[model samples]
Target: MQTQCGGCKQGGARCCCRCGCHSTAASGGGARLCSLSIPSGRSRGGGGATEICRSPREGTRKAGRQAGRMATRMFEGKDHARVYQKYRFTPQEALQKAVFSYLDRKAGAFGLALDVGCGSGQGTLLLASRFQKVVGTDVSPAQVEEAQQAPHPDNVSFLACPAEELPVADGSVDVLTSFTAAHWFDIPRFMREAERVLAPSGCLVLTTNTLDMRLHFRDRDQELTRIFQEFRDLLTPYMSDKVRLVVGDYEEIFEAVPFPSKERITDIVDKVPMSVAELVGYVQSFSMFQAFLKDRPEEAQAQVQRLQERVLEAMGEASPEARLEFWNRQVCILASRGPVPDHDPRS
Candidate 1:
């Protein structure tokens, strides 16, 4: 039997949560800010999830002071940073809507939009057309510098800072987001910074694509998918446990969100098309893959090359010319600073 999304019972089976993990970033380690109740069980297939639980929160004031104090060498190397800037997929239009649709309901000015963990600034630049000013902040100076070097409007800027701390003044940011990178954060501590920076009724959106990804080719979808899955499985051991937060759809992160007016949207799917070489570039941008390379450089290089060769073999084609569709499921967690509004959260 296929299970539905616990959030909406809309589609797909849900994945089970093994995340009994706890963090000291907040008080009362497992508390739920259940403005939106979560289903009792795990999500499966393309299932949606409605979750609730408990986790403590850090001091917002303290979070602000810690900003600019920690700039880790995250995504530091020149080649890695360049690949991250070039290969990382931008947040698709649907994901952006998941954020903006909620923000439209908000009551304050939409002057400043801050993107935490804004690696390479793809998502950050998307905000420029809407917000008066946009800032993308990351913990890696290298990533920040790459974002700066990119051609962006004057209204968009970049910074090197950690998620747990932000250098901005209190109640300054109108909309805050962390795309595909919140899993690497001390979420409870980061939530404190989220609370610190957002203006009253401001929106905070945290989003990431789940691991149930698929690679599709015109007539060879299933085979290409198997190959991709094989590649992912090989890299699994290299992935940090931090990725579990994403697999769990940020349930723990939601639990820790200091706000009471929070909800989630699940099963947002996006399909990006790329050539075999380009797909390899995207995979190479994975920090996990980078870790694998660090541990066994020759083996790592050999593995990806093998993956490329196998894919071409499967395609029965030359030149790696086959363009394939890369698909992913997205989950977005949205929280409002002050009160829950009267309109439909889904609306």
Candidate 2:
């Protein structure tokens, strides 16, 4: 299972897994011919080494570019962070129950849990009830500050960190969870970080609710659903490429997980009752919606007003007190470092 360069014996450093060739030389050469024996009929000449032509300066530049890209944050500004905190829903009880049930079956320490990309500590607080300690990390300093301000248990703390580079020790985390946030991460790099921080047999739970949502009303379910779809379509242009991964139900993310014992559960629907105004606020909480507001304030405001007016008209009430059901379909990807010997059969 280990991947390393033959010359440097360093994993994930210029090693070609297929040919077992080390692109960089271990003897301080700018480029070197791979010293390993080449198989016949391979890309390299028979019993001869193919020179790797990358210079040290070129490698440094490539590393710098990657670091810069990793530092880039999608959601910014204090105003947007405040909007998120105001409108985003807390972790559903059903989802929390499912996560705890899965973790209970695994034979490992439950002392520490890491919640990556935890916005405003909504999901992080849920972990505090189960684990002895919970640390939430996000790339946005504004979001981290907001999370810190929220009233949470003594065991819960918030930090500003990227998914690829966590401020944690190797194999020290008992459970790692990301709620509706993995889509915004660099999947491959984040997976590696998960591998590094997770203990043996530790669980990695990643979940996200899909954007293909629906709304239900008494005898007006069809009309409400249509209106919601229209609203979703209108916001489509504002969605980033990462959002497409959530739309795909995390299929690409599941594949990126390094664990062999991994499973994906999709279409776990939850019905939540809310008023028309609350639903409008939920839509406004979306990162893309905020981005749209920044890019086209007048157009975004008009669209929001139009959607709100249509919903209120359909409900046959000027008051926002009419209760409607919001059905959210969530996808969960569960993985562990090793096979659980006594996993719950029902889970």
Candidate 3:
């Protein structure tokens, strides 16, 4: 379905950021929109002709200060990137299926794919076999280096570059994606660049898994889950305000996409199997947790220890090697530059 908007005259009727500025998080996942911020009502656009009410906010690099900070590059150094690589598991088949379904293409059918903010290239490699050539770009040099060093198909390459300043030629990318990283971007610039780089029939995907993650085992799911949440809660103070974009399910980022054809799917669920220790490692991989460790080393170490101890006790496991389940609810935004590829399901 197509919706048209993005027009602003009187300094742009842009009710933009009107959402982020007013909407509060509901207990069950949704925004309680301020009466003045009519989501379905026509507002003005600051950059385009007509503004659709679906998306939340955006502006250019020259105006990065408008968004406060232009976003600083984090996850530096080989040690940190390697920790990210080892603990941060990529979303598997389910995510791919959602993208393919949106693109209306079979696996391995697309010509080129670009994964922006691709940390460690895990998701970039996931696209390699599917596309004839795949390039992963990240702001972090260490991340790019790690991705380059990973075992990957000959079609894939990695480089360090900011998302707003893509090195790609215009209209050259068939599919563009940012996984779990758009929140940290200068949204307006990145969105503009996404439109510039995509083929007319290309699509854009931005996905981030919500932190409402769950822990599971045989029968003691509730207690185990509590242990995980409590552990995560302790790390909350270290989380950046930028993470609010994710907590809001990328509505703000989605607002930036210029495409008239776009959809947000908040129900994509990804399940990963892991050992209890690995689950803890995944949390350790969190940027917030890393920050916690930096600011409060002894306390951070104690928290990790406490988490392992509590989780193990709850599971009646003697060691951290016991099997565990990691489940996440992912938020995905799929938008086409124009028309999606002509595709037949049975083909």
Q: Which candidate wins on lDDT?
A: 2
Tens-place lDDT digits, model 3, residues 205-259 = 8999898888889988888888899888898899988899999999988888899
Ranking by TM-score: 2, 3, 1
TM-score of each: 0.77, 0.78, 0.77
What local lDDT does model 1 show for residue 248?
A: 90
Q: RMSD for each model, in Å, please?
A: 16.4, 13.5, 14.8
Candidate 1 local Cα displacement, residue 59, angstroms: 23
| Residue-level lDDT tens digits of model 1 in 1-347 | 13222322213212111121111112322211111112222223335443322222322223223543542234657789899999887888788777777777763556668888888898888888887667777776567667767787766766555677665656767788888888878766787788777877678888988988888877887998899899989899988888888889888888888888889877899888888888888889988899889899999999999989988888887777678788889989988888756454434
lDDT, candidate 2, equals 0.71
Ranking by lDDT: 2, 1, 3
Worst 10 residues of 1 by lDDT: 16-25
Clashing pairs in 2: none
Model 2 weakest 10-residue run by lDDT: 31-40
The Cα local distance difference test for each model comes to: 0.69, 0.71, 0.69
- Candidate 3, which ten residues in sequence have the lowest lDDT sum? 29-38
* lDDT score of residue 66 within candidate 2: 46
